[model samples]
Target: MRKRIALLAACGLLAIGTAAVPANAAEPVFPLVGPSALELPLPVDGSGAREQRLSITLDHPATGAPFAGLFTVDLRKVAGVATVRDHASDSSHQCTEKDGELLCAYKGLPVSLELDVAAAKGAAKGATGEITVTGKVPGATVTPLTTKVSVGGPDLVMREMKLKKDLRPGESQPMPLVFANEGTQAAKGVVLELGTTRGMELVETYDNCRTRTAGDLTTVLCSVEGDFVPGAAYELAGDSPLHIKATAHAYDDVLRYGIYPAGDEPKAAASSGKARAGRKLGVSPAKSAPAAPGLRASDLNPGDNRREFAFHTENTADFTTSPVSLKGKAGDTLSTAFVFENKGPAWIHAANPADSLARTVVVVPEGAKVTGKPQECLAVDADGTKRAEQLGAPRYECALGNRVSENEKVVYPFDLLIEKVVEDAKGSVTVGDWGTSAPRPHAFDPNAGDNTAAVVINAKGGTGTGPSPSPSTSGSPSPTPSASVSASASASPTAKASTAGTGTTAQGGNLASTGSTVGPIAVGAAALVAAGGALYVAVRRRGVRG
Candidate 1:
């Protein structure tokens, strides 16, 4: 019994010792300490093109003799066109697994990974993929650290734009274009290029606080005068639209170049692998589409019992038609029809009967002629410009009365008799009329006219005489408001002018000497305007009319 008891005691002691000695499981293992995380650079505010880097500099969690060799790090996946290039040291050979961590003692093995990101111009802006870094332990499982690759901070931004479409040949309109920078850094250089449709020419270009007329063809290009700072907006007013081809190319002189840095050396161009081919990477501007055109004017004829007096006008809100084009040539006299629309605000005040009439002009080529009394509603200037009197003029007033409410607009339509004549003529239709009341700011772009309808005139075919000649009418025509004029009523001048017979006179009225009341000059001005319309109308008719 004593021997058995001694043997049992020895066996129990040996078992306890073995348990305390610990198996391989109790030994510290390399790379088993914790998961790895990443840090990324982003913008304080959201704007501009994004370019950023992914940073990795976290500490390892575990330490042990088994983690004595090198490890590998790589990106697991990438979407879109993003790519990793010039990778940091691929292997960590000199790493030491000591204490409770894995440490790379030399710079040859990168402690952090850096990469240059360049989103393609058409590339989507956002996180493109994930990166995984794995640390290997000679006798233990490989540990992986994962992070997301994100894009942030923009380089350039578009602020505002004034673009127009569907311009007629030889036509030009003005636009106000604006730009800005929303990045943390300054932009070095900027340039704007002029593009036109195939048949259109850039009539004029203006910038830098100046009135636009004709631009110097030689120096038509525009460039930024100074470096642009973040959050700064630049404006280029007086840019005009031209009638040209649809596939025409309009872009910056040089789309992109080098960027200025905040401090340190400027970042170099991205590697071939970093560049993407089809990504949209920047903010664009918003714009409005073009308005539809007017109907043809000279198509009015008295066919059978139905009388069709067709007249067209461009860029006007409303119009009224008369049988004038068919008057003398019509075999039968029937009622005419008119079509029109009111484009501006519903509120506008006008006293003239024609103010409610929609007017239209049938452009007569310089040589065309008509037979019957040109439509009674049609008014002509000394030079030959045709004005439709039946169609009331558009009223654009600030306030219904003297108060500033909403901007106002009104459209007028008219009807006229169709006249027939025989003569070679060409012309375009003028749709809108100048109001008797003071002129207001034009609501739409000048070149983006409402509609231009082409017309043909013939005495035998039922067309009105081209247009009437200047009237011997009296009283000053309403004046067109200027840019200098203020929209507010308080800004209106308190002066008044009344004309007595031909002699000059000055009285208590605050009417300052405006200028001469040369009636013929005004008539000539209207005629010249009519002639321009005639030319455009003839061009379109070549395809639609015989």
Candidate 2:
């Protein structure tokens, strides 16, 4: 009976074990699971904080089964934690804080949990920290999710101080003071102060500021409301002397309370104790402390901001011409050169080099006709009309183009034909006159006497010798005496004596007009006179025989 009962019990145990093996084989296997990492935006100056919402979604290989696990928020590596709130309010889950961490437990195959966190105020700028969310599955291992946070703050810097106008005694000028906020945080309730040295004054300002005068020096204090944003510039209020200094001050609330003390409230009692100690020692009490603390006033820029300028008197230009004198005879071509020079502390159109500054005019001698002139000069009628026909002594107008440098000189050559007798006849050449159509005349000529040059011409013979001179001095001389007259009048005639006197005068005139500079025109004049000699002799011999 005992053997039979033991056999039945063994069979029953075997049957139960076989049934459990199949049941265990039917269970599903799951893969890995983890939460997503996050990066939060925080200010560098520790003046501002950022809030981030994080979600941890369980990922598994099994599709049908739900996640069953426990999770915890590990904040031991995070240095600045202001607050943390659980976002599992709508779910049937409980989250409790312990040892600066949050712990939660849930039963499901695939589950998602959320958390909202904020950075602490007064956190040190550039400080880096991390928070982690770790999870555990009943049957599988899971990876932890980590997020990084950084601290930031504000930085105030002075860029430059510039003078916008020329400095002169008794004149007001604009001096711009430029400043910029370089950091990521904003600066609030900033104050700017300007102090000047003796001989400097503050006349007017665009910003609302208080001014105080001590001797010739001045002080200005101005305030700015609200916050000065990062990467923004603050320009000067108005025009002031360049000899001045500026300073900026603000309260550093973030550094004093949030970062230093590791709390949201400042240590007023500690500061109050210092004030009390001062009062007890018979010293005056200190002023009320600011809300934030780090630096009270920013260090003044490292370089010199003052500027100095020199002044000089206005400039003037003096233009002058050299003296001119010449003598010529009828039918003789005479050429003379005139020189114009500028003696100046300033050049013509010095303020603007591209403009026309002056005009030069040369009046032809009445007894002489205009024949040749410099290429830059234009022959004009007495009325100043270009290319117009004139009976005698046409005028020429020349531009002083590009001759604007100080101490510069320009030479003008004039050519003329002596048509009539001129006894010490005088002509003139003037520059910077109102008669020109040029834009602006020279400012002024210090010495007007030298601006006009005198020209003298003498035509030894009369007009009866050749055709009437053209309105222009360039008219051609009468045709050369015919070859028949030249052979017949080759012998000496009594009329030759009168002709000899005329020849002597003509030679003298040629020398006076050209001063060692003989040209083709002078040679042509000599040939014409030789031809006239032949005609004169032939006529005189005929008269003698009659």
The lDDT of each candidate is 0.28, 0.43
Separate clash counts for every candidate: 79, 19
Q: What TM-score, computed on C-alpha atoms, does each candidate reach?
A: 0.21, 0.30
lDDT of 1 by residue, 437-530 (tens): 3222233313224434434344345444322222212222333322111111121221112221121211111112243311111110010111
Error of 2 at 208 (Å): 42
TM-score of 2: 0.30
**Where does model 1 exceed 4 Å of error?**
1-154, 205-221, 237-546
Q: lDDT score of model 1? A: 0.28
Against the true structure, whose TM-score is highest?
2
